[model samples]
Target chain A: MSKEKISSQEIIDLLSAQTDFTKRQSEDFLKAMFGIIEERLIAGETVKIKNLGTFKSQWNESRKSVNVQTGEEFVIPGFRKISFTPDSELKNLVNEPYAHLEAVVLDSNHEVTEVDDEDTEELEPLNILTEQALEIKGLLSEIQGIPLTKDESKIEAEATVEIEENNTAEIPLESIIQIDPSTENLFDKIQEKMHQKSEELSSLEVVEITKDESEIENSIIEIDDNIEPELIVAANNEESKIEAEEEIKINEEIKIQENDQTETKSNYTAPEISTSSNVYEEEKIENHYTENIIENNDKDEITSIASDVNRVSEANNLIDNSLDPVDYKIKRKSKWWLILIIILLAIILGLIATYFLSSATRCWVKYELFSDENKEKTANVKNNILNIFGLGDPEIAPKPAKIEQDSVAIQAVAEDSIKVDSIPVTQSKDTIVDVFNRPRVYDEFIGTEKFGQGNTLTNISKKYYGHKDFWVYIYEANKDKIKNPDNISVGTSIRIPKIDPRLIDLGNPICLKKAKELHDLYIEKK
Target chain B: MNHKELISAISSKLSISKNEVEQMLDTTISICTDQLKEGITIGFQSFGNFEVRKKEERLSVHPATQIRTLIPPKLVVNFKQSNVLKDKLNEI
Candidate 1:
């Protein structure tokens, strides 16, 4: 059998091979299933898989304990735990490989003791070597004992155990010491434990009143000599108190970070329970100190402790203002008002667009007729419609259509002679034509005659004006009927216009004499 | 809900065949086991986290039989719900 554990990728590959799914699809399916299971479990539901197993959860209550050696009591907080049990089918399948194998009876206890004896035999040389190692530890403790007590050696050993338990993979003491600064609160805890031990030692000292105080002071001086010269220099200066304050603040900050301890504890993953055991010691010591402080109700003692408490509080305030990092919550204003404004603007714009599109551009059909008379009739009909609507005539005035007499005669001669003759007609006169040419009303016709074949404006002019050169005037008067001045139909009556006297050449004596005679006749008539 | 209800619901939500959902669910158990064997923690945010805790070797006596057994250290899967989900449950 392959020793390699089945990874998610491997499962995906297997699923892809077995089912009609790609590796990615298999992965997604697995994720979705796991997500569902997690969701159900979180809702306090027991997940049961038929013929496989069932998964459920239980709560392990916190256990309270007291350590006899340190007289420390603490509680291990309660936590939720999950459990699983396989069904019979799955269990049978799992046990199938070992079914044929029988359990062999062995002297496990005897074998363990034998192994232990062999281990001790192998450790004999190391034990002898460690005898020399003890001397170094003895010297180290001797220096430490001046500041603390015999109990501290055991505490130091326990602290080392706690460090080893925090990270069993990395056993180096230097690495553990490096982590000490970060675990400054834990160090404060150690200090608190030392203080309690010191109290106990002091109480014991009270019994030995004969003991010389100078010897203790001398031992302290010796311990001071053993310390680094820089520390001694710092101890002698005023700045030392500030440094101590900063150190205390750092530990207080660590205490403030209790929330982060849970995540960090997971990172430790220590197999041994020594770290928690140390926590018990710290908790017990805290309770003990609180009790002691409460019992000592004397004013002098209270005042002394109160000063230290005040100083610590002042340091904490300084640290909180200068060093404490707080989370800043960024406020985000809602955009509903802006959105409403935009929507309103859009609605207004749409309304305006629609209004202009429909009302600004008016559609009307402007009909144009080929015949001028038909156009005039249509205009009259339109004007009648406007009158019904209580509106005046069109904004622009209409022009009257002038029909040629030839086309008028064609209709009168062919079908309406009686009607044409009955209508009052103007008499033809040369003098009338002359005055009509002056831009005055020319209601009197200059001349009217039936059009003949091969007749043009020149022929008509020769007949009406006594000169063919005056043909242009006739053409101008009848331009509506005569599309081309060169073409005039037979039997079509034509209207001749009056000639301008100033346009006539007086250089011809005969023509001038005729013009003068006409002028005299006109003046005599006047 | 029971297994059948669970299967039906998954089928409707995923819009897949019931067989497919069943296969995928079976695969989940194996995957969890594999991860647990490797000491890997699988976490689903706002829902729960799954991890394997190591139980140390110990000697235990059966209360009824009065026989002692040496229980070897073994890995076990642990699941803890996220606070968000826990709060959701508290409302009920």
Candidate 2:
């Protein structure tokens, strides 16, 4: 396991051991196999080996590029590359360890909620409480006047009724205590002062009730022309007592007509009064009740009224508590919306600024590129930009042509110099004709060889001429022995002619140009 | 060349029977496959290296429907050509 890399030699050794072949035989087989695969791939044929993989050659298209430092544009010539795709069995075998693993389909909404659970947990309870408060507020508004609709009101009504009944029973004893000598005389003046305020409130209430009676009389007179005075007296007695009792009863059955005066006044003024007003009302009611005890004037009425006021104040306090969080939440939501809007506005402004800045820079660059004075430099820059963007340009089309012409001109100059220098050598070897039908001299033979299986003229040429392109010269030397240079039979005897130093010179560009020309000529002739 | 031609060529080059060459090739391939299954890199000098590579799991979305699909991770056989082979191929 520690030795991760298995070399080709090891594979050959393994093959020899497993197949009962010699090491040399396995080695030669492996070489021939790989060589044939390579040959087929180079010939643009796909080689598919059973239980292994398919090897194919892919041609990459030529692309344009620019040098980073020099900013010079150039084209990268395309070449073929070998690509191998493994067989399905091999793929499955390699993936055997992870074969059991599978892909799972995930619900987007479920995943999102799971990710947000931490943040939502902190916020959820507050949201639930607020929702509950809103529901309670709606229920309270619907049953605001009905006391039994609220749990606290139901219990308080029962307690108040019991207390009121006990006070009625104890009225005589309370009056006797009021008549006691020492404490009665001392409380006399405070009792009178408190009685004055109660008298005024009661007087105002009587006036409002009388006005309500007048409206009722007008409505009754319209219905029946003659209304009896006895009936009016009965209405007043029942109205006053019922108004007092309805506030204490805290029930839904309270007659709307009888309770209208007091209920309307309480509804109009209750919510406007703050907690301080509530304390003042409590103090005033307590003093008024003490006065009622001293005077012994309908003590039960005073007790019931006091209890009703206390109940109203408690209801108001409950409402205030419920409403405060709602108001706070509204204000918090408004603040968040304002902050979000401000942030959006800032981002929009920043984006606008950046857009303008980029446009300005682009305009400046365009102006510099299009200006007449920098035409030549701009052309070069334009070419570099086009190369960078992989765009073709008409101006760049002539650049390679000019380079080729210059190369041809240089080769012509070199050929002229070579002709002038090789006059004596050409005159000595007048019998030998070159591929171009011109007399060319060669040095004495370096060697003689027989072309065998797997032997190519290019390989032979590389051995002697140091380049595969010089194979044209080998073909020219073996023209009489060979028919087609592309197809040579095995065991063909071929001569390896020693070329003149100037003709096959590696440093001279003319040698390569001449060899290329000869190659094109021979191919055209074939 | 195909399997038959490759086997015949190897047999002729090594002067062995085609059956022997085919057996030797099958053994070589089986051994290489076994070694690769064990996660070893089989390197051939002046040719290429064959090894197992792990492809990571990924999420792919359909362009039109926008349906997300999870691609499970798997081990795959990979081949990387040596620089010598690359240079030889580019020589053409």
Candidate 3:
């Protein structure tokens, strides 16, 4: 940042250690410098410092751009450009003192063109030649350790003298270095393009002439019929060579078919021949030689060359620049749309998954984890198991438990509601309807019962009545035997009988001997 | 009502199937948005009323910085249940 002259290498080495670093560090530093300038410029700000110069923002006006794929135009919004100014010291350092340039322009007659006072002096070739030729020549000369006679190179020896004359001088090295690295690519492309144009122009076919339809009878000709040469002789102007050349080739082809027009009635090969010639001509124009370089050398004939061929190359090269606006706009819009759609879909899927996942998680939380009621039920079942295995407390006896039963005539029951008042053995219809869900459940009934093991009722029924559901039949048959129905007398000898009275009606299976005896008794009694 | 009668009634009305109706009901019932022009009230017969009503903005403190700021005014959907429907459902 100081005004003192210093080598760029020294400056780079001073900041952030580089002694044990790799080439990547060098790239990183350079990238950082470029990135800073680029970011600031893109944000529409100017970077300025005294002497070293100011980099100002240059915003481009919005304009139309084209899409290469579809060849469509779109609007590209205005962006920015980076501009740099070199400090006098940095300028002096970057552009080592160099030799001067001497100029002379030759006219069409090879005579020196007289200088006109009205002409801008900046167009004088001395500065341009110095910047282009002398600068490179000096650099290359220094690198190769060769001596140069160019005036610009000689000034490095006379650097002491320049310090006295100019207070703040421009060495023209600022813009030169800042021109960007890709200019070399542009230069090579330009050269390749010029060569292509030149080749295309050189390949255009010689034109031909054809006889008229009405003149087919006059087979004899007085002239050589070389109309291709007629036009070459017709206009000597090379300025009109391209147009005149194509017409002459067509005329020559026409001449070749004059005698056979009746036989070759169709359009024939004219289509391919014409197009090929056009392609040849286009290729000729595309490979235009470095016209600018030649343009500078030959200002007089340059006008004609540019008018005839360079125009075509210029158009192609402009298309190659890729500064189309509309294409970039479409790309930007689609980029946003793509991002939007991705985010939208992600959100929708997230919501659906969240709904299902939350419900499933809630179910797991309720049923699988931390359920106190379930823990109690499992504890009781575990106790029962332990008692069956004679591993539980002996004081808690393996008591045969009573089973719950409903009043036979009861109907509906609330899912969550429990009966507060017990239904009597002979309850009213309304009470039955509210107490039990169905008549089937009332077949066996009990007001209240103690909880038991899983097979307690089945085992007890088998022990006393030799039937599992006989417990229910006992409760129904002795509806008045016990008031509480749930409270049974420990010593009561209740009569237990067959459950279904209809069992007496179904005929019993016959014993063979009893069947014969019964038949003999019936016959004797008859 | 018993599941048999409920399923049968819903199935016969839809003519398609109860499963299909359940799917449609699934889509129609849950959280969703209704765009309200300047003034409008959405009425879903037994469900409820979603009314776009004027909401007044007031000053409140932002929790982060404890800064009192005035929020903007806008219309918000306010829901109110139909008493007739709510009573009928409570009875069931």
Candidate 4:
């Protein structure tokens, strides 16, 4: 996975460690790292981490980008992107170590003069209580006992806080005793006996309290401020949110009664040593070890962070060394060409389609309007065609196909023999019905049909035109006789007019087949 | 820990004269707490984040004592330590 990951370290190691480099090791390193990452990107995979960010590979699209100098458009082929984000672990380490730092002073002097630690044995009734500050810390633990943090400073502070919290809230202080009425009297008795218990507790303390009077007062007041009275309230408030008041009340009653009665030589009565002090001792030891490791780890982490930052700096430096500021700006400037090209292509395509719509309507008029059988059917088609041409005639008026035998009869009346009676479309001004009876010859070879509709004009055009696509062109030309181009009788001879040589080579005489081709080509150009 | 208690401890731990530390802790707490109070969530970059949830108001039961309880909405605290802290504490 690391091989696939874009890693400069892995690259350098491959070149400097396992693999020997003959000439430019750093260059080789770059090649190896870039090559692998590029290969993976081409394979289309995004690398992901369980608790980190994803490294995605994406490609840009090809487009008709503009040439900035000439404002001319050209194409820009797509390129790939390989991007990364810092892992959660790495990111966390990058920030400062948790603001508060605690370490065991294996090296620092006067460790004993600092925080006081308590002993665990069946000893202290009100352990280590002093002459001045022995006033607070009520009788015993409530049912939801206090958290026994090993920090003795917190414990001493906890005692001092009793005065401040009760100083005003004492108005509602009984509310707590009401919580544990059963233990209420017990606590009251314990409170009364607190001074005596302190003496007994002092005797049992494994660690002696030095008789440093001034130090005790100074530290006591400081610790008092530290011991959070509000935290206790907040904790209660937080818990009470989850616990029922009634249940809490009942439990408080039991707790108060049990401790109060215990002090009265009750059966459950025994030594009144506090258990919190012992819990604190255990925590103190744990804390010392934690501090020791934290310090050692701090050293290692500092070195690691320094190297990481150094490596990142080195990577950034390489980029600076390889590229010039001016070149970068030029490259950025060149992108406008890309933007211009994209917009231009989109617009060009839109205009082209719009242009075709205007021209394509001419095709529909040629096909649909010329096929209308009834004058009523022609109304809709005529109006549509009329909208385009203003007042011109139908390009070719609808008429019925004439049988080949009718040709001899048509020659007898050949001057005006066209079956024009069937057609009723308006003719254009200066329209010529037929100019010369001496029609030119169709140079293209003729077709022989074995199957398909016997549309006389269309089949003849396909055979002579060398393309099946022009079948509609023939239908369009002979629309005057072929009212419905879909219906036509075989062997029906039809008139074919001469066309320009570029379109069709009707050399000497324009036969019946040639005339239709000329007419179709004429309408197409128009 | 409740907001007030946690702030006090944090201040004491930093040991910046109480008043100054108190302000710092208060500002940080206020931002996160206000967001949670509004039933919104805040994302801290590395430290644990705070969010407000439905709290699941419900009827409670004590099978042993055959008691029924009607519990109301509650606000709970959740914490996730940063990897750096986890690793540092885990160092041997």
Whose lDDT is greatest here? 2
Candidate 1 vs 4: which has more DockQ: 1
lDDT scores of the candidates, listed in order:
0.45, 0.57, 0.35, 0.35
The 10-residue segment of model 3 chain A with minimum total lDDT is: A205-214
Tell me the TM-score that candidate 4 gets on chain A alone: 0.13
Question: How many residue pairs collide in each prediction?
Answer: 1, 0, 50, 27
Give candidate 4 regions above 4 Å deviation.
Answer: A1-447, A450-463, A466-526, B1-81, B84-92
TM-score of each: 0.25, 0.33, 0.14, 0.14
Query: How does residue A131 of candidate 4 score in lDDT?
Result: 24
Residue-wise C-alpha lDDT for candidate 2, range A174-234, written one tens digit per residue: 3433333432342343334334433443344344444344434333331232112212333
DockQ of each: 0.06, 0.38, 0.00, 0.01
Shares of reference contacts reproduced by the candidates, in order, are 0.08, 0.70, 0.00, 0.00
TM-score of 3: 0.14
Error of 2 at A70 (Å): 9.0
Error of 2 at A21 (Å): 1.1
Per-residue lDDT of model 3, residues A1-526, tens digit only:
1122222233234322323333344334333443444344445566553333455555558999999999999998764444445345433333332112122333322121232233335246644665788789888777544222223333332221222123122334333333323433443443354445423422221001111110111111102211112122223434343333233334445534432331221112111111222233222222221221232345455456446446755654554343233234323523332333335434644554555455544653464235664454345445444432335454542111110112111111111111101111111211222222123323433233322443343344455545443355444444555443345565544444443321111131112232234335433554
Which candidate's TM-score is highest? Answer: 2
Off by over 4 Å in 2: A1-3, A64-76, A109-526
